[model samples]
Target: MRDILVTLLVFGGLPYVLKRPMYGGLMWVWISVMNPHTQGWGFATNFPFAYIIAVTTLVSLVKSREKNSFPLSPISLTLIVFVLWMNLTTPFAMFPNAAWNQYTKVMKIMLMTFVLMMVVHKREDIHKLIWVLVISLGFYGVKGGIFTIRSGGNDRVWGPVGTFIGDNNALALALIMTIPLMYYLMHDLRRRWMRHAMLAAMALSGLAALGSYSRGGLLAIIAMLLFMWSKSRHKMAGAAMLVLLVPLALLFMPDQWGARMDTIGEYQADQSAMGRINAWYMGFNMARDRFLGGGFATYEPLAFALYAPNPAAVHAAHSIYFQVLTEHGFGGLAIYLLLGLLTWRSAAIIVRRARGHAELDWAARLAAMIQASLIGFGVGGAFLSLLYWDVPYYLMAAVIATRAQVSLHLGPERRYARPKPLGRPHLDAAQTGPAKPEV
Candidate 1:
């Protein structure tokens, strides 16, 4: 049944996708983020749905005459440079086979992201794309939240297998990033029931993040909440809800959960934390020694033995910073950081320009929420080895696409192109100027 249903959706939607390639982009996001086929117990689990959709989307885009131009900006160029650098480092990788395989996956992600930039041009398209992402990730958020409540937060929340967010920490970070998007959707929605449902999803997603039992996730959620509150229009209501719900959620969790979280303060004594720190040191050593670094999958026991202080304790570069540092060297990390900083600045620019424009109000709100999401990734990512995860890049693309939409609405001269003063023109006409202006 699952196989049939998925096949039907893909084949049936192919016509529409061909007609409008953006639909295919949306489907790709759904498949990539949700990994719906992975939930099946049958042949669907092995189907190449995402690849089929991606190929179809690209083919359709090529055959069609739509203006599918890539957005050339600082962010996009930085991303291109980053991708090129990653490929350049792959040849020098310690484990060439593993590095090349990971490179292939990243290549697919970047291709789809650029496709998104081309097709997702309109306001409606942007909204639908965001909806796809919200629904895809929020499925886990709502499910995990209920599981956490039912299990008393004893078991951690994990994502579907074969997906980017398969681990508990990854799921928690994704959920934390999603809460702000949910809030934006709730406000953007018109129907009362829809808004209320989105509100429920937001609350549940927060609980789900807690259920992950990730100390980094805990910190990320705090950062997300702080930024959301600061950017919110109704500060009192946001604050009141935060004050009321946080303690209740904590009280509901089991003692084991609290005990696990307490390890954050005693990191030096915790094996996991110490392991991550050791990995960080090894990563630093690798980058310092090799200008191109060890490349992907180079965090092997041998590399650790060569660079680590305690050669016996080998660990993954659990930090994104360190992950990039070791995988692609300091140059790659710098480019990666530049991409993030530019993406963030792009979102901020949109928020500032869309502030007073009634038509672009949604853009402003979306940009602000996206900023919050990036903040979640930036903070939570420091402790997670999700350097190649595509979600953050997708957010960056959304930010760029949204800013473009707002710019188009504001016209070529942009927001400063105000209406000419009627009184001044009328006065000039009254003073015997050409009678072109209305009084």
Candidate 2:
């Protein structure tokens, strides 16, 4: 019953995003490439996804909590409990009403973060979301590519006025995620034409990323590509990477590309870096000053208004760690790092055990995607705030839920009765068995 609902929601966007690579990829076909509108133009926008997510979660929670105590990782539970604790213990959270509001707000994000992963319990659910991303983001990339070319290679041009969403970084990160998906498509493909088409789409997606002129995104995509290459253990793919960079050089080597590339050195010359250093200092001091909890999202604005150089330009701290610490104190930072570390640990287990078939392939593929998302979010968060974004947290939650599911299914001993080992066990072959990938 639950699986059916999840499938329906994912299938809602299949036709539109075939060529593009992100959820925002569907806006290209109907809306003008330059349309500035940002309303939900297709089926299952985030609002609807949120509703479907809510329904699916309630069902899963009710079913699981009623049936048996759902197994949870201590690392995940501790972090979640800590976040709740910080809000409850806020210094000025004296009124019950204020505390209730704060609790609800935190709960909202925490719940929203896990929606995708919670619904995606089976391997098929993961498959469905991959299609969702491919169809939605794929078509958007196609449209974006057309627009980028029309503008004489201006990478900053986002979507049509309002309908087309995604900054350059969003576009790039989406493409980075797509790389593994394409590899999977190729890996799973039985037809030559289908394999060719998937590779073509991958190329177009790369073009779209460069069109965004988002250097950080380009770098993030490169990181994911490097990960894929390292995992392949293939000499040809390694050589091809250098060959691929030639076309990219011609496309992005404009007057500003060099300066944009310098963003890699953000910690040195970038004002954003200096601001982060200042913000980190302030965040640490604030944590020492407010041991339990200081304030929620509302606190940062006040600090920026009072202490920042340009008070009128008040904004988020741009670092997830500092943002959580300043808002919820050191306790929040502890919880934040704990959750991330737990996720990485789980992902590592999955990656190490990824053999070559359906389940292990997914485990390995998702682990890489999660790793890339973490590194991208972490690196990008150094300059931009991602606390409010669903991508990072949702991916993290997926890692947790997926990890638990895979661990249960592939544990040394299955809980249920086991099948007798027939004449020769299928596990003998590296391709068919429990052997890990060479990576």
Candidate 3:
């Protein structure tokens, strides 16, 4: 049944995807993020759904004369440069075979991301893309949250097998990032039941993060909540939700979970934390010497034996900064950091400029939520080697798409002008102050 359903969905959706191209982009995101075929033991498990979807989308996009061209932003440019650097570093990798294999996977992710930028050109397309992400990953979040609640938070939450976020820690990070997107959807989804359902999903997703019992996940959630509340138009309401949700989640988790989190304060004594620190040092030393760095798989035991302070404790570059620092040179790491900075700035610009424009209020809300997601990823990623994870880049694409839509709706006269920093006068008399953030 599972195989048949997945087959039907893919084959049935292909014609529509070929027609719209944008739909193909959404389908690609859904399959890549959700790994729906991995959910059950069926024929669909071996099907090449992503490849088929990508090809169909590419062919359709090339044949069609869609008015929605890719937005030329700093974010997209930096991403292209980053990909080139990634390829350049692979040949110099400590293990060329392993590095090349990893490079191929990373390339696939980047290709689809660019495809997304080209096809997802309208505000409606952006909204549907968000919906695809929310539903794809939220399935795990809602399920994991319920399992945590039922099991008293004794068992760990995990993502699908053979996927990027398969571990307990990774799953927590994905869920944390997803909660904001879910909230964004709730604002525009007119049905009362759908909005309420999204609200529940957000709560459960938070609980599921706690259930993961990851120290980094805990810290990431803290940072996410702080920013979500601070950026919200109505501080009291956002604060109230956090105040209510946090306590309930705490009460739901078992004593063991709290003890695990308590280890954050005693990292010097925790072996895992100590090992990560050692790897971080190795990454720094490798980047300091090797112009192109050691490339992917640089964390080999032999390399650690040569550079690490504690030579015996070789570990993976758990930090994204270190992951890039080791895999690509400092120059590459610099570009990666700049990519994040520009993406953040772009989102901020949207949130500030859209303000209270009734039609574009949805864009403002999305910008805020994407900002919150970045906060979660930034904090969580410091301890997780997820440099190539699709979520962050996908969010970047969404930001660019949303901003373009806002500019289009504003018309030529108001378009192309730099958005004033927040708190200044609105761009035009039509623009109002920030709207009260949706509850």
Off by over 4 Å in 1: 412-439
TM-score of 3: 0.92
lDDT of candidate 1 over 128-180, digit per residue (tens): 88888899999999999999989888888888876779989999999999998
Q: TM-score for each prediction?
A: 0.93, 0.69, 0.92
The ten-residue window of minimal lDDT in model 2 covers 24-33
Q: What lDDT does each candidate get?
A: 0.89, 0.56, 0.89
lDDT of 3 by residue, 234-352 (tens): 89987887788689789778899989888999999999999999999999998998989998777798889888999999888988999999889799999999999999998988887
- 375, model 2: CA deviation in Å? 2.8
lDDT of 1 at 432: 85
What is candidate 2's TM-score against the reference? Answer: 0.69
Span of ten consecutive residues with least summed lDDT in model 3: 424-433
